[model samples]
Target: MKKLAVIAATGLSAGPAFAATGPFFSLRNTDFIVLVSFLAFVGVLLYFKVPSRIGALLDSRAAGIRRDLDEAKRLREEAQEIYASYERRQREVAGQADQIVANAKREAEAQAAKAKADLKSSIERRLKAAEDQIASAEADAVRAVRDRAVQAAIAAASSLLAQQVGAGQRSAGIDEAIDDVARRLN
Candidate 1:
């Protein structure tokens, strides 16, 4: 009914203005033949259900487009998930790397401390050894000096006694002094 009203309005509005050469309904008129042909073409399209088929085709195309859009959206979401997973892995790797670095630092510090302790011990041992050697040398030097002094005193006393005493007394005193010196040395 709406189509009929639109057609009627179109006919009434364009009829007189365009059909200027002759009677608008006459078979000889070009405008009338053209209008009839156009109407016949429209009627054939309607009779064959072409408009419905076209609508169906358009609906199927739209559905295909919607499916494509949905697939694209799903793919985008999957990509985002993959990206997030990679980011999480990256963060984990970074954390592991940090942990490794921390461990290495701790190990290095421990080794350094151990080395320092070893070095200190080594130095202390060397110092103790050096002190022992020095003490030994000093003892040897003091003993040598004491021995030299005792020998000098014995020589001086023997010389003085030889000069001061008579031969017989000197000999007897020397025997007694020798016995006393042997006893004292022991």
Candidate 2:
């Protein structure tokens, strides 16, 4: 590597000297002056270590970019976790609402069954009362018919006794008939 560098330097110096129109080392030679100025500028850059400083700056910038990317990834994962928690809560609430609706329906069905039973009982009681009233009315009608038959029999007996018996015997016969009728009625 040292040999190659030396060869390259010799070539650079010789090539400018050959190309110059006058003495290569003299101030009148523009090529020599240009070569000196370029060498000085290169020497100043090397003395300050500008290339190493630029490399360090670029490496620090790359590290900062990597940290930002890591932070963004962590924040995205946290947001996803929060979204999942909300979804779970929403599902739980929906399940609770469904349960409430089912319970309400059961309650309403129970109420309807109770109402039907009550109505049936009420109708049965009314039917029993109507039957009792009809039985009472039938008993009253039978009693009235018996009373009318007894009265008509008494009137027929009185008319037959008057036609067949004389006055004194008729009174005695009527008294006997009344006593018999009272006994039979009792």
Candidate 3:
């Protein structure tokens, strides 16, 4: 109603003579037709509230975009945190692996040293046993030689005694032995 009042005021201000002189709907009256069409378009736009609806649509779209951007930012931060956690875990696992390797190396070295010591002890025992066997063999050889020497000395002495005592001497010694026995009896 206000727009109608404004249009009416405009027409009135143009003067009654201007309306009377022009053909209202003629092709020759371009300016008047153009003015009417422009006013109708403006009226339709106002009746539908097209500009405010467009403003509301744009505001909602902007809010949705803002929310989406915030969500993207939050997801990015979460991803970064997860990545950092994984990196830290990886470093810890690497350290543990290194320590495990070091421990294994130490254990291996200790085992090797123990083996070396055992080998040395075994060699020493074997060497000592061999030496004892050699010494026992040497003692046995010495005893055998001494026994042979004693047998040889006894055989030589028996030969010497047999040669020194003749049959006549043996008889005289036997007669002396008999007289000595008779005296003992008396």
Candidate 4:
């Protein structure tokens, strides 16, 4: 590479000198030699099939690029499909969650209603029991009062009869009661 640069520099520096002294169509010119050298270089490259090799290299590179582009496009489509599937799944999950919430709410409402009914029934049963107890207590009190009154009336009648009867009448009454009892036993 250094040698090529040195040669190119020498040629460029000598170019003006050659142009000033040379006929326009001279075969002994430095430009002619440079032209011949360039032609010879091209001829050597062709003889070695370098042009065809370069063309093949470029074609392979293009094929690789095209394959990469196709792979990228396919990957992009797959990613989009996966994203769409995830979105669909999310929506389904959201809908199921809504349904679950609705079901939970309905169950809560039913439970609340059942609790209210149970509480009401319990209260009603307690109230009825209390009323029955009150009524029974009232009947017992009335019976006790009637029993006490009957006992008092019987005592009063016995005391008045005892006071009104004389000793002789009381003895005759006892004799009569004894006769009546003897007759019943026989």
RMSD of 4: 10.0
- Give the Å shift of residue 18 in candidate 4: 8.3
Please, what is the TM-score per model? 0.56, 0.51, 0.50, 0.57
Query: Whose TM-score is higher: candidate 2's or candidate 3's?
Result: 2
Quality of model 3 by C-alpha lDDT:
0.82
TM-score of 3: 0.50
Q: What Cα-based lDDT does every candidate model obtain? A: 0.90, 0.90, 0.82, 0.84
Clashes of each: 0, 0, 0, 0
* Residue 109 displacement (Å), model 2: 2.3
Candidates arranged by lDDT, highest first: 1, 2, 4, 3
Deviation from truth (RMSD, Å), model 3 = 13.4
- Tell me which of candidates 3 and 4 scores higher on lDDT: 4
lDDT of 3 by residue, 50-74 (tens): 9899999999999999999999999
Over all chains combined, what TM-score does candidate 4 have?
A: 0.57
Which residue runs of candidate 2 sit more than 4 Å off their true CA positions? 1-86
Q: Write the per-residue lDDT of candidate 4 for residues 1-186, one digit (tens) a residue.
A: 999999999998787646556663567776666777899999999999999999999999999999999999999999999999999999999999999999999999999999999999999999999999999999999989977876675556556556778877866665665566456544
The ten-residue window of minimal lDDT in model 4 covers: 177-186
